[model samples]
Target chain A: MNDKVAQTVKTKGITRRFLIIFSVAFCLLLASASTHYFIVERSERIERETRELLNIRLGKAAIERDMQDVISDLTFLARHNETSGIFLPDNLDARQALAQQFRVFSEQKGRYHQIRVLDETGQEIVRVNYNNGEPIATSETLLQNKSDRYYFTETWATEGRNTYISPFDLNIEHGEIEIPEVPMVRFGTLMFDENGNKRGVLLLNYLGSTVIEDFREATANIADHAMLLNSDGYWLSNVEKDREWGFMFGRNDTLAEHFPDAWQRINARDTGQFSNRDGLFSFTTVYPISSSQGNLGDGLGSLPADTSYYWKAVSHLPPQSFSASLGEFLRRNMPLYSTMFIFLAASSFIVALTRFHHRQAVSEVETERSFRELLERRVDERTDELKTAQVEKDLVVQHLIQAEKMTAIGTMASGIGHEINNPLYAILGLAEAIRDDDSREQARGHAGKILSYTKDIAAIVRNLTGYARPFSGTEHKPIDINEVIHKAVSMVKRSLYDDRIEFRTDLGGLPGFSAHSEEIHQVFFNIIRNGVQSIEDDGSLMITSRYDGEKIVINVKDDGKGIAPEDHSKVFDPFFTTKDPDQGEGMGLYVVHQIIQKYKGSISLESVVGKGTTCVIEFPILPSVKKGNP
Target chain B: MMKQKILVVDDEESVRETIRLQLKSTGHEIIEAEDGKQAILLLGQSNSHGVSVIICDVRMPNINGIEAVSFFRRDHPSIPVIVLTGYPDIKLAAEFVEKGIFDYVVKPVEKERLIAKVEKAAIQSAVMNIVD
Candidate 1:
C-alpha cells in the first residue's frame, strides 16, 4: 500500500497541482471577500441615509401637527369672541378678561411667538406675547395693514375657520417698549355669529427656529445635514441656518440648498425622496394640515386644500468616507494574512521536494540491483568461456609435443642409417677383394674361407639397419652377449680398417639376457664405432663380455684418444656428439643410452686423454630364458 | 752352401703362400707353418738342418707366432728369427726384434725387401756361430 502511494505521488505531480489549486482558490476567495466588503459598505451608507431621511420626515410631521392644533384653538376663541374681543370691550373688566384668555392660549402653544386679537375695522384691539409684556400702540400697526397681513386676510377669507399663515415676521409693542421682530410661522382664524355674519379675527405665531431644532434631533445619528423648506423654495428651518438658501441649491452649494428641491417635489404632490447635487440624500414627507381655521394667516389661501406642510429629512453618507476606513482596516491586517499564506506555501514546496528525492533514491536502488545482476551473469559466462579455451589449448600443446618427438626420431634414423652404411660397404669390399685374389692356387681356399666371414658381416649389417630403423613391432628375446659383442666389433672393424686400428674381442661366457636383441646390437655398434673413430692414428679397441651374477656386462675399451672430461657426461645427451657433423649426427650415443635404459641396463665410461676410453654396459639376465630361445 | 732356408708361419694361408713365393723367387729355400704349433715344431727340425732364419705372422690359431719365437729362443737361441705380419703389430714384433731375432717385415711381403732382410739374417747367423 505504501508502495502504491509512492507510485501515485510520483505519477500525479500531486504537490505541484495542489499548490496551484490552493493559490488559485485562495486568490478567488480573497477577491470575492473584498468585493463583498465593498458592496456591504456601500449598502450600509445607503441604508443609513435612508434611515436618517425617514427620521427627519417623522420629526417634521410632528411639528406640522402641533401648528395645526394651535391654529384650531385660536379659531375657536375668535369665533366665540371670548379671546378676540379683548381689545373692543369698553369696560376694563371685560378687556382684562379677554387679554387674560389670549395670554393663556399663547402660553399653552409651546412654539408660538405671539397671539393677538383685532377688531372688525382692523385695529389691534388686544395682543398676547410669549414674553408676557403689555402691548404697545405699534402693535396696532399690524391691524392697519390687516388687508396685507396673513393673519387678517386669512381670517377674512376663510369665513369661520382657522387658517395657517406662511412663515413671516411679526411686529409687537408693549406700552413704551418695542419688542424685537420675530420671524414667525403663524396661523389665523375669524369669529362668526350663528347666522354666519363676520366677526373679529384671531392670529397665532410660532418660532421658525423650532423646526430646524426638531429635524436636527431626529437625524443626529445619520451622519449628514438636515433641513426643512417651504413650498416657495424658502427654508423653513436649516440646521446650518447661516448659509443662504441659494448657497444650498446648486452642485457646489451647502447642505441647506438640497432642501428646496426636496420640498418643492413634496409640495407639488405627495411625499418624495431624492439625492441632490450638494451630496445630500433627502426624503420629504408632506403632511397636509387643515388651514380652514382663521388661526393660519393669509398665505393659507395659496396652500392646496390639503396644505403641503413639507418636512424634508435629508441625510448623506459619502462613499469616499466609508471606503477610506475600510482600506485602513485591510492595511492593518495585510501582514498577518500574507505571513500565513507564505508559511503554507513554503511547507507545500518542502513536501514536494522530499517526495521527489525519495523517488530518485528508489530508482537508483533498483538500477543498481539490475546492474549487479547483469555483471554477475556476464562474469559467469566469461569464466565458462575461458575454461573451455584453456582445455583446448592444453590439447594442442600435447599434439605439438608429440610432433616434435616424431621429427627428432626421423632425423636420428637417417643419421644412423648413414653411419652404418659406411661400415657395411667396407666389409663387403674387403670380402670381395679376398675372393677375387688369384695369385696362389691356395687363394681359392682362402676365398672359400672368407665366405662365412662375409656372411657374418652381412648379418651384422642387417641387424644394425634393423636396429637403426624405427620400431615396426614389439618383441623381446634372450640374446647372447658374445654374439652382440662380436657383431659390434666386426662392424667397427669393417669401417675403421683403413685407419689401421685393431680391434680385440674377449668373450667371457655369460648367461644370456632377455631384451630386444636388434636394439642391443645397435647400442653396442654405436659405442664401439665411436671409440674406433676417436683415434687419430693406430690404436686398439678391446671389447670384453662377462657375467656378474644376474647380469651380463660388455665393456668396449679404446686406446684411441680419450674423450674430453667436460664432454663425458653430456656425450649421452641427445645431439651432443663430439664427432664432426659430416661423420656424426650426434644421436649415436644418445640412442645407445636410451636403448640400454629400455633393457633395464646401465652404461658407464672411463677415459684418459692419451691412454683410452672404456664404455661398460650391463644388462640384467632373465632367469627364465636360455641362450638359444627365440 | 745350400740355399738359405726361410720359414714362414701364418694362420692365413694366403699370407703364408704369398711370403713363400716371394722369398722362393729370390733363391731362398722356403719352409712354412700354417699355425704357431706347426711353426714351433718346424723350427726345432730346421735348426739341425742349418736354417738361417724364420719369418712368421704374429697372429695365429692355437699358439700365437710371438709365442713360437719365445720357444725358439729357449731351445735354440742362436737361430735368427724374422717376424712377418698381415697387419701392423709393431709392439709384439718389437719384442722378438729386441730378443736378437734376424728382422721383422709386414706383409703383403715385398720380394726385394724380404730378400734383403734374409741376407741380413744369414750374415747374423754366421757371426753368431762363430761367436759360439
Candidate 2:
C-alpha cells in the first residue's frame, strides 16, 4: 500500500505542472499571432486606399487636358486669316480655303462633330461635319442659317476676341433630340475683322465622349469603380452606361440618388480623400473651363471666366474591394500560425511525457527501495518519537526555567524593595522638613530634594518591574549588552552594597545583537550576583566587557572566596551551589548556562581556592547583528 | 546640655541631604557621610568626635550599616546606633536588636517616629556620658 501511494504521488503533481505550462504556451502563441494578423490587414488597407487616390488624380488631369485641347483648337481656327477673309462679302475663295482648313482639323483630331463660321446675322458661311471620323465640307447652298442657335448668338454678342464654352449636353438637331445620342460641347469665339471690328462667330462642336474616354484610359486600373459626375450630381461616365447622362434621360440614376452620402462630400470639396462604411472615396473637381483658360477675351469679353463649370472625377472602392478579407488573410497565414502552435504544443507534450515517464520509473524504483527499508523506517519512527519526547522534555525544562526565573525575581524583590524605599525614605523626610521648616529658603531646598528623590524611586520601580516579567514568546529585539548589563546592575546594585561588594564595570564598545533584554539581564544578573555572594567581606567585583574583533568577551572578576578546580565541571550542574540551602535554589548558573548556549555563547570559570574567581564569557557575534556601538 | 553632633550615613546623597534638612533647626550640629565606611572613618577621629547618635542605612558601599554597628558595639560602646533598612525583616531586626543596636527602623519611616527614635537614642547616649 505504501509503495502504491509513493508511485502515484509524484505523477499527480507532474500532470498538473504540464497542464499549466501548456496553457501558458498556448496563450503566448495566440497573442503573437493576433498581433501579426492585424498588422498585415491594416497595411493592406492603406496600400489600396493610396492606389485609388492616385487613379482619381490622374483621371482628373486627363479630363482637364482634353477640354483645354478643344479650346486651343477653337482659338487656332478663329485666329486664322482665312476666317477673317471668309467674313468679307464676295470672298468665295477665302470661304473655301477656311472650309478646307476646318476639314483638315476635324479629320486630324477626329473629335469635332461640326466646325462652322457664322456671320453677325448668325448664318453659317462655312461648315464642316465629322461624319463618323470622315470630314466633309458642306457647300454654301447646303450650309444652313444658325442665327437661332444659342452658341452663334452668344459668341457674336462678345465684344472682343473671346471664347465661349457651352455647358455639356446631348446634341439637339431641328428642335429634336439627335439620334445616336451624341454628347456635345460647343466652343465658340467671335471673329474680328482686320480693323478689330466684330465680323462673325467661329464655332466648334466638341465630342465630349473623347474626354470621358481619356478619363477612363487614365484610370484603367480602377475604371470599373471610377465615376465622372457633373456639378449637378449627374453621372457623365458610369460603369453602367444606362446610369450615365441621367439628366438627359430624366432618369433617377444620378450619383446623388445612388450614393447620397458620397455625393454630399464630393460636391463640397475640390479635392480630397476619405473612407467610411461605404469604403474609400477619392475625388477631385475637374474644371472644364477654369478661370485661366475660359477667359480668352483679353479684357474685352462680357462674361467673366466661369468657376462653376466643373466635373467631379471620383475613384471609389466599395467595402468589399478595400476591406481586407478575413478569409483570404487567414488562408495566407493560418497554416503557418497553426503549425507553429501545434509544433510547440507537440514539443511540450513530448517533453512533459518524457519527464513524466522518467519520473514514474524513478518513482517505482523509489517505492521498491522504500518497501525494502520499511522495517528500518519503523525503527526510525520509534527513534523519531523518542526525539519528539526529547523536544517535549526540553520544552518542559524551558517552562521550568521560566518558573525558576520568577523565583529568581522573587529573591531580587528584597534588593529592589530597598532600592525603591531608599529614595522613598528621602522623599518622606524631605516632605516632612518642607512642612515644619518655616524658612522659605529651607523649604525650597527640601522641595527640590523631594522631586529628585521621587524620580529616583520611579526609576527603581521601573527597573524592578521590567526585570520581574518573564520574556514571553521569545521575541528578540536589538540590544546593547552594555546597556543590559547596566540595567541588571541597577536591579541588584542596592543588594551589592548590602554585602559591601563594590560593583564596577568597564563596558567597551561592543556590537549589538538581537535578544530578549530580560533574558540577557537575567544571565548577567545571575553571574554578577553569584560573584557578589561569594564575597564573605568587603571586596571589589569588577566586570570588564570588550569586543575581541569577532566575539564579545566579558570578564567578571571577584576578589572573594574562589572555587576548587575539582568541582569546576559540576559547577554548572543544576542544584549545584556552595551557599547554604536557605541562600539560593541553585538553578542560577544552570539557567545561565542554558541561556548562553541558546545564544551560541560560552562561559567558563577560572579560580583558585582562597583567591578570587573570574567568570570569562564569550558570545560570538551573529551574522545578522549590526556591528558598532550598541 | 552641650551641643551634640548627629551623624547621618547612607549610600544615596539625597537621603543624607534629607536627614540633614530634617535635623537643621534642632540646634544639634549635623554631620553627613555617603556610606558606612565614611561614617566609621569620621567617628574614628579623636574621642569619636562627640557624635551623640548615628543614623545608618543597612545597605551601603564598602562597610555596610550592620558591619559598622558591630564595630561601634565593640569599640565605642557608649555611642547609640540606629539601623534604618529598606528590607524590614523581623528576623534581621531581632538579630540587630540582640546585637545591642539602639533601634531598627524600616525605610519610608514616619517623620515623628524617626525623629523620636533619634532623640531618644541621643538622650540615652548623653545619660551614659553623664553616668561615666
Candidate 3:
C-alpha cells in the first residue's frame, strides 16, 4: 500500500518533468514557426507592393509614349510643305490637296477626332474629321472663322516651330457639352509658308479615352486597382468608371476627397509607393507634352516644357488584397506547418517518454539500492541483537551457577552446622573435663583431647570454607580430580552420616588437568548431594575416578531410591527434582550438567526403580592441560 | 538422696566424658553411650536398669536423639530424656518439649548450666519413677 502511494508520487513527478520539457519544446517550435511565418508574410507584402509600383511605372511610361506619338504626328503635318503650297499665288488646289491629305491621315489613324488647318488669325482654313472610324472633309462654309480655342491660338502664338497641347477635357461641337462625353486632348503646331513665315496652325483633337484605355491595358492584371488622375486630382480613369472625369461631370468625388492623406503624399512625389491601414498606394506622374517635346521631328523645335501638366498613375491595393489572407495563407502552408507541428509533437513526446523512462530506471535502481541497504541494516541489527542475547545468556548462566552454588550451600547448612558443632561439643567437653579434673595426669589427657578436637574442627571448617567459596573468575589451574571429589564429598559427608547413608570413593591415580577447582567441586558436590538426598534410608554411594590416557572418567553409583525411567531424562533439567521444595531447589544436577558441558565433558545416567542409579561423567584431556602430567 | 545414675548419649566420647567429669562432685554414676542406638542397647541390658536420666545428642549416626527419646518415652516412661545438640534451633526445641522430653540443650553449653540441667533431669526422672 505504501509502495502504491510512492509510485503515484513518482509518476506524478515524472509527468510534471515531462510536461515541462514538452511544453518548452513545443513553445520553441511555435516561436520559430511563427517567426518564419511572419518573415514570409512581410516579404510577400514587400514583393507585392514592389510589383504594384512597377505596374504604375509601366502605365506612366505607356501614357508618356503615346503622348509623344501624338505630338510627333502633329509635328509631321505642320512641317509638311502642303500648307505652303496653298499660300502660293498660282497654287489654287493646295488647300484642296491639304484637305484631302488631312482626311487620309485622319482615316488611317482613327484616334484623331478632327484634323484641321487654321490661319494665324485663328480662322480655320481646312478641316478633316474622323467620324467614328470614317473620314469626312468639312466644306469651307462650315469651317469656323476665328478660333477662340486654346490649342489653335496657343500654336499660332508660339515662336519658332514649337507645339501646343490643350488640357484633356470633353469635346463640345457647338457650345454645349458633348452628350456622349468625348474626352479629348488637342495637339497643335504652327505651319510655315515656303519663305519661312508661319501661315496657320495644325490642330489635332486627340481622343483622351484612348490614353485611358492604354492605361487600362498596361495595368490589366491590376485593372481594378489601377487609377489615372489628372494634376487637378480629378480621376481620368478609375475602377469605378463613373468616378472618372469628375471635374468634367461637376462631381465633388475625387482621389483628394476620398483619400486625402494618400493624395497628399502621392501628389508630392513623381514616383513612389506607400501604405496605410486602409491599403497600399503606388503612383507615378506622367508629363505628356514636356516629355514628348524631345521626340518631335527635326524641323519642329517642340513646345515649352510644361512641368505643371502631369497625370498621376496610381495603383491602390486594399488591405484585404495587400495583406495576407488567413485562409489563403493556411491553404498554401498548412501541410508544411501541420507536418512540422506533428513532428514536433511526436519528437517531444518521444523525448519526454525517454526522459521519464530514464528517470524511472534511475529511481528504480535507487529504490532497489535503498531497499538492499535497509535489509542489510536490519540484518546487522538482528545480528547485534543475537550477540547481545548471547552475552546476556552467558551472564545468566554465570548467575545461575552462582545461585545453584548458594542453594547447595543452603542445603548443606544443617550438615555443616552438625559437623562444626560436633567438634565444638568435643572441645567444650574436653575443656570442661580438664578444668574439673583433679589429677594432673587426667587433666593433661583432657587437654590433649581438646587440642585434637580443635584441630578436627579447623579441618572441617577448612573443607566447608573451600566448598562454600563464592564463584569468582573463569581462570583455570591444574587440579587433582580426586582431591576435588574428596572436598565435594566432605561437604555433604556429615549429612549423609546423619541420614545413615554410607559413601565411598575409589580414586585411582589420575593425570592433572586445567580447570576451576571450585567448578569441579561444585559438579561433584551437586551429584553427591543429589545422591544423598535420593536415598530414603541406609543407602550407600560410591564414587570412582580414573584416567584412561586420553580422558578422565568418574562414576557415581548409589543404592538408593532410584529415579524412574521417565524422570531420568529430566533429572538434569533445571527445576526438575524429586526432593521436597524445602529440601532442594532442583538446580543441583542441572548446574552440574551445565558445568560439565562447559568443560567439554559428557555425563550419562542409568537407573532402575527401587534398585540403584549410576551416573558416569567423562572429560577429554586438553593437549595444553595434559602437558607434563604424570 | 542416693547418688543418681545418669546415662550420657552422644556420638562424641569427649562430650560423654565431660559430662561425667562435671557430675563427679554430685556423685552421679556417669554411664556413657555413643549414640541413641548404643543407649537403647545399653538400656536393654539387665545390668543397665539403674539409669535415672539420659542426655542424648541429636543428629547422630544410626538412631538420632528424637527417635531414641520416643522409644524411651514409650518403653521406659520413668526415664527422663534430655536433648543435647549443637544446633540451637527453636523449632526443634519446641517439638521436643511438646514430645514431653525433660529439657532441650544446645551443644557448647556452659558447664554450670549443663550440670544444673542434668540435676533437674535427674529429679524429674525420680518423680517419673514414682509416678510409674
Candidate 4:
C-alpha cells in the first residue's frame, strides 16, 4: 500500500516533469542558435566581400581612367602644330614661340606639375612648370639636361609610334625636393616628322594628388579603405598614408610585407576578393588607364616601352561591413525571426514553468504531509473506537455472566431451599429440645448444635447473595482462581449428590489476576455445574488449575456421557446444548466463554462420544499480574 | 412395658441429634443411622427392641427417603414408616402417601408435634403387628 502511494507521488511529481521540459527546450535552443549562426556567418561574409570588391573596382577604374585622359591630353599636345614645332623645322624664333605655346597649354590643364620638350640630343628645348595651377616658364639656365633621365633615355628606345610612361616619383629641384614634396607621374610620347622621322619628345608631369582625390571620391560612401599596388608589389595606395608608395623614398616596403596573404592572392588573380580579421580585400588590375578598356600594348603606342601599365586596385573592408546582410536577414525573414521570438517565449515559459512546478511541488508536499497526518489521526480514532467497543462488550458479557449465575442458582433453587431448610430443621428442632424436654446438660449441648446449624445456613445464603450481587464497580480487583473455584464447587455440591456425580478438584496455588470476583466465581459455577449435569449416573467431575509462567490454566474434566465431536466446537456457543430443555439452559457454557474472553482468554473443549469431555480455559497473565511471592 | 425401638435416618448429624434429643424425653429407644440405606439395614437386624417406627430424611447421600419408604412397604409392611425431610413439596408428600407411608412431616416441626406423631405411628404399628 505504501509503495502504491509512493508510485503516485512519482507520477504526480511536478519537478521531474519540469526538468524534462527544461532540458529538452535548452538543447533545442542551443541547436537552433548554432545552425542559424553558421548559415548567417557564411552569407554575411560573402555579401561584405562583394561590396568591398565593387568599391575597389570603382576606385581603381577612376584612377586608370584619369591616366588615360592624361595620355590623350599629352597625345593632343604632341600632335598640335604649334607645340610640336613641326612647322618650325629647327627655326629658333618658332621654337621660342612653341615654348610660349607649351606654357599656355600647361596653364590650361592645371593638374600638371611640369611640361617640357626635348631635342634629339637630349637638350632642353622648351619647359614649363605649373605650380599649384600657376604656370611658370623656366628660363634657359634653370632648365636641366634630360640626357641621364630615364624618361628621356627610355623614350629613345621606342622604335615605333609609342608613349613612355615614367615611374611615379616625387619632384626634385637642384637635387632636392622643393619645400613641399610634389608627387608626380610623367606621360611622354615621341614626336614623328611628316616623313615618319622622329623629332623631339613631348613629356607631361601629372600631379599624383589627382589619383588620390579620385580614389577618395569613388570610395566616399564606402566605409573601408582601398589600395593600389604596382606590378612590383609596391604599395601605391593604402588607408595609412605613410604606408603608401614606400618605394618612392627608397623605403621599399612591398604590399607583400604588410599584407602577405592578401598580396599573394591578389598577385595571382586579375579580380578576386579575400576576407580576414582586418576585413575584406578585393582587387582588380586596372592597367594602362586607357579608354580602349583593353591592354595599352595593343594600341599604336605598342612598341619601345620600358615598362607596362602595372597597377592593381584593392578595397580593404573591416569585418563589420559583412554584417549588413546578416542584419537584413534578421529584418526580412519572418520565420527565423519567429524562431528567435519563440525561443525567447519558450525560455520565459520554462522559467515560469519551473516556478509554477516548484510551487506545485511544495503544495504537493504539504498535501502529502497533511494526508499522512489525517491517516494517522484516523487510525488513532479507529483504535480508540475499537477499545471503547471492547469495553462495552466486556460490560455486557459481565452482566450476562452475572445473569447466568443467577439463572444457575435459580435452577438449583429447590435443592438450595432443601439445603437451607435442613439446617433450619436442625436449628428449630434442637432449640425446642433445649427449651422444653431436654435435661439441663443436654439442653446446653443442643443449644451449641443449633448455633452451628444456623451458621451453615447463613454461609449458604452468603454464597447465593454473593453470586446474585449486582455488579456495580467497574474497577477490577485481584482475585485468586483457587478461592473462586472452591466457592463454585460448594454451590453445586448438593446438586452433584442429587445426580450421583462425584466431584473432584485440584486447585493449584495461583497468582491473583485482575478480575471481578463475582464474575470469576460465576464462571466457575457455570462450568462446574455443566460438568456435574453431563453425567447420567455415577460420573466423576474433575477440575484442575495451574499456572504456566505467563498464563493461568484451568481444566474441567468430566467422565460422563460425552459430546459428539462435531458438537464439541459449538458447545461454547450461546444456546448450544445437547441436553433436554428442562435439564439444561444452554447459556451456561456460553456465559463461561464470554467471561473468559473478557480477560482476553481462550477456551476449548476435548470431548469424545461416550468417553469423556474436558474443557480447558487459559488466560494470558497481565503485566500487573506477577507471581504472588513472599 | 417393652421400649419401642425407632429408626432415625438423616445425612446431617445435627438433625439426627435433634430428633434423638426430642425422642429421649419420650423414653423411646432411638437407633441412629446416617442415611436411609443404613436405617433399613438396622431395621433388618431386628434386635430384641424391635423397631416399631422409621423416620427417614428425603435428601440423603446413599439411599434417599423415597427409596427407603418403598423398601419397607414391600419387605417390612408391618412397620409404620414416617418421612422426615428438609425440603417438603406437596407433590413429594403425595408420592410418599401413595407408596403407603404412614405419615410425612417437614423439618423443624415443634418438639411436641414430632413426639406425638412418632408415638401415634408406633401405636398404630403395634396394633397392626398383633393382627399380622
- Per-residue lDDT tens digits of candidate 3, residues A1-630? 999998897678767876787688779877886787788777888788888988888888789888988987887887774345665545547877888988889988888999988877777777888988888888877878757766766777777766677878888877877878898998887778666787877889998888888888898878989999888888888889798778876898888898999999999998998889769999999999788886664754455687777889999898988455556677788898888878877777677778888888998999999999999999999999999997897788778888988887776676667777777877776777777667899878878888888898889878767666776777888889898898788777866436588888899888887888888888988888878777887889999988887899999999878898889789888899888887788888888888898899999999988878889999899877776444
Best by TM-score: 3
| Arranged by TM-score, best first | 3, 4, 2, 1
Could you give candidate 1's per-residue lDDT for residues A86-184 as a string of tens digits?
A: 544465566556667766666665566666766666666667667744332224334343555556766677643535465432334452213343445
Q: Give all candidates' CA lDDT scores.
A: 0.61, 0.81, 0.82, 0.76
lDDT (Cα, tens digit) per residue for candidate 2, span A263-286: 899888888888878878889888
Question: RMSD for each model, in Å, please?
Answer: 20.3, 28.4, 8.7, 15.4
Alpha-carbon shift of residue A559 in model 3 (angstroms): 16
Model 4 chain A is weakest, by summed lDDT over 10 consecutive residues, at A289-298
Q: Calculate DockQ per candidate and list them.
A: 0.03, 0.39, 0.33, 0.38
**Which residue pairs show backbone clashes in model 4?**
none
TM-scores of the candidates, chain A only: 0.48, 0.54, 0.66, 0.53
Question: Using lDDT as the measure, what is the rank order of every candidate, best first?
Answer: 3, 2, 4, 1
Candidate 1 chain A — worst ten consecutive residues by lDDT sum? A414-423
Point out where model 1 deviates above 4 Å: A1-23, A79-92, A108-110, A132-145, A159-162, A168-182, A244-269, A272-280, A288-305, A308-311, A323-630, B1-132
* TM-score, per-candidate, Cα-based: 0.42, 0.48, 0.63, 0.53
lDDT of 4 by residue, A362-402 (tens): 98899999999999999899989989988898777767776
